[model samples]
Target: MSDSLLQLSAIDIATGSNPLYTVLWMHGLGADGNDFVPVVQTLDLPATPIRFLFPHAPLQPVTINGGHTMRAWYDIQHTDFIKQEDKAGLYRSQRAIVALIEHENQRGIPSSHIILAGFSQGAAMALHVGLRHPDKLAGIMVLSGYLPLVHEIRQEAHVANQLTPIFMAHGSYDPVVPVKLARSSLQLLRDYHYSVDWHEYPMAHAVCDQELIDISRWLKNILKEALISDHQNR
Candidate 1:
């Protein structure tokens, strides 16, 4: 699957005539890319031109959900996410996401000017793929999700994103992905010395108004820094 081209469908949003920065945002399990479209409109972003890509995950059977087919990045074999790992599905989706990043590169946006982000299962993908991506990225943003395939990350993580900033937020009352799991992931990243900015909301399994504000601020800051770095390198 890694060698094959991915034909995943997506919705594109360009904030200006020519976008200088790109964000690849993935949706949660069972949901399409359109899940987070409305949230983008609520963010108070900077004046910098940006392009946002929301890609739909491929349809697959989820074992934990009674083998029901849905749009999931990987299959969940059990409620204990760490127990039964889906290596094949995770790596396949990682390659598909890498294809999207490469697509952005072909369209004139460098990896340094791109941000990979997601929510829930999508968030897990963002952490999994961004860490292993061979090129430097602007940043990674994760919301209401835990890290998957944690055991393999240390060996497989690329050096390009070793210092990339990470923004993680979670709902305090999230039942789907317990806040404890999110905290453990944060701790793991920190233990590995990754730069992580963490936040907790008073909601459950979803984003809130304050979380959107924080996301906007983080995005603007990273983009601003990326623009500066790009100019300096040129």
Candidate 2:
């Protein structure tokens, strides 16, 4: 609802050209839109032009960080994340993210051609918003993040994306977001019959090369249609 949409950096096709698809990515706590810019380059994507939008979270005081102000999707009230949730902040960011999705719709990219992705706190946001999004999406990618609002996701999650593919990856040795948290989230999605392509790497909270390879492969599978369409036009 605010000007959060303006706080984004996009890697787009050439001027005056419209991309057939878009990937709206979000950054983790304390990071800005530039955090994942380099990751895009490493992805072995389809030939079809794809736009990537990295939106920055609004600067706010994070309680877990001793009230230090930083760019975070929501305020962490406690170390035990799900015990006491930030419902207000979560919904606030959700509206902002929904606005971003609508902005893409106005630019001629339908929800079906867009992928929602994020890492850490950003990943949590992506999962929260993407599930409740009214329209079907290409897919949801979660990197080192867990599902929030689990108690209400069943009631809140839209039916449109129930069948949407989900790609989730996490590190086994992750201290920040414990691997068990990610696993439980995966189990919850499976319990609800959501199609999830899950992966685990032997690393820390950071991403590994193998994980990137897996992510690239998953993206190719999701966007293969665009690749085929682009080839026909060429």
Candidate 3:
């Protein structure tokens, strides 16, 4: 499918008047944008105004789930996720997400003022796309997900976001994506010299209160730096 045809429906939340930053957060398999909406209110963000876009993944038949139709960024062929990859689905979703970032730029938010984030399958997409994005982004936050299409990342990643700050958190007891897989992904990024801030929570394949607090603090720092940098550039 064409990128235009894959246009996603999203939930938009603005934190204050004249928002200066934008956050595009994606949800995991079988979930919609509304999945993370409640977490927004809990984040202890800075006083700066911010806008959040929670986009619903396209509906597709997931193979691992007995070909059941559900909202997924891409298909999961097997439990051994690294072996069988979904290149086409990933590329399609990447284009759709890039379109969302461009939409924010069109609305007056620079790419540098945007942060890409996700959980589970959504977190995989954040890592896949954010690294390849041609423009510099404020940062990327990934929770409970592993890097997909690993072979292509080294060749496809863009220099613009090479040094972009990355916040990665994984649950130690994540049965779905496995803590080991997440750690391997982290090692790959680190081997490539990516600046990553890592955290681990003693939970499952889900977000927790402490994770929310850490995310809030990380976002606060990132946006604060962005604001300062933007002011200096003026």
Residue lDDT tens for model 3, 100-173: 99999999999999999999999999999999999999999999998998889899999999989999999999
Pairs clashing within candidate 2: none
* lDDT value for model 2: 0.87
The runs of at least 3 residues in candidate 2 whose Cα sits more than 4 Å from the true structure, single-residue gaps closed, are 1-16, 225-234
TM-scores, each model vs. reference: 0.97, 0.91, 0.98
Model 2 C-alpha RMSD vs. true structure (Å) is 3.2
> Which whole-number lDDT from 0 to 100 does residue 101 have in model 2?
88
Candidate lDDT scores, in order, read 0.92, 0.87, 0.94
Count of residue pairs whose backbone atoms collide, per candidate: 0, 0, 0
All-Cα superposition RMSD per candidate:
1.4, 3.2, 0.9
Best by TM-score: 3
Q: Distance from true position, residue 66, model 2, in Å? A: 0.4
Model 1 misplaced stretches (Cα beyond 4 Å):
1-5
Question: For model 2, how does the per-residue alpha-carbon lDDT over 151-195 read when each residue is reduced to its tens digit?
Answer: 999999999999988999999999999999999999999999999
